[model samples]
Target: MSVWRRYLVKDVTGRLVDLPSRLFDSADDGTAPLPHFAGRCVELVAAVIVGDRVSHGRVTELAFTKLYFDQLGYVDAAKRERMIRLMLESCADRRCGSHRQDSHRQGDCSRLAHRAGAARDQLSREFGWEPKPDERDAALSRLDPARLRAAHREPAQTLH
Candidate 1:
């Protein structure tokens, strides 16, 4: 069975771009790149929490993660929901610089916040579920990925 999936990407005009499934398929040996599943989750969250100053860096990191997710077959509903909540939480920052350009505080990625909302909505629509409040803060605060090791995934290589 083919496990095809799609996602929302941001266009130059700040519109949601519907990435097609054909983009996920591999032609040479029929194997796409690995989805850095957890890595993606981390980057998306960082983009919001870190604000606009670091948004580009974080998005760059998540881009690879998204590719890996597509290659590994999309995540389950629960995990997807968790990711959405994080996006929502990050976007809730009141000091979004793009929307408040005059603000003195640094790192205000208001544009990314909007994109996060779009992504959260798209994920919610695709999964047919309502977005719930984030209850992962306490747990997330104590989380440390540096402790994780080899069991997470194998190294990448050419499929063909």
Candidate 2:
């Protein structure tokens, strides 16, 4: 695995507090890099929360956690709802490719299952409503990664 991957998987300290400095240090002209490192910080934070071994930084803060989840496509109220619905469906006894792999490899299932449940709870708390059955079905039907990606690209207005 590459250094970034290793760092992500093994480094318990999620302290990238100096990420700004690290990213800016390489810029001789003082201009921030494209795709801004600050923007990527959110992704890293999400990755850490999703099981990457990053532990130094605090991820529980409302602003930072919200930013990270937003960048990961969980901030849009609709998307978040859809994600939770999909998770609930996946949690059902039905079998599928992803579920099969997860069953064969418990580690993946544990991480994914934990993350899904957590995301669902987080959405429920934010939205203040229990998930409806139709919403659950819609979420399950859209669980395929390709379909989800396409939905994300659609210009549909987000609830958030």
TM-score of each: 0.21, 0.21
lDDT of 2 by residue, 57-92 (tens): 211211112222233222233444664675574464
The residue-level lDDT of candidate 2 at 138 comes to: 37
Clashes of 2: 2
TM-score of 2: 0.21
lDDT, candidates in the order shown: 0.34, 0.34
Candidate 1 residue lDDT tens string, 1-160:
1222333333345333444345433411235432433223211111111223322111111121222243343433355566567556545654453443554343345566666677656554443321121211211221212212221354532110
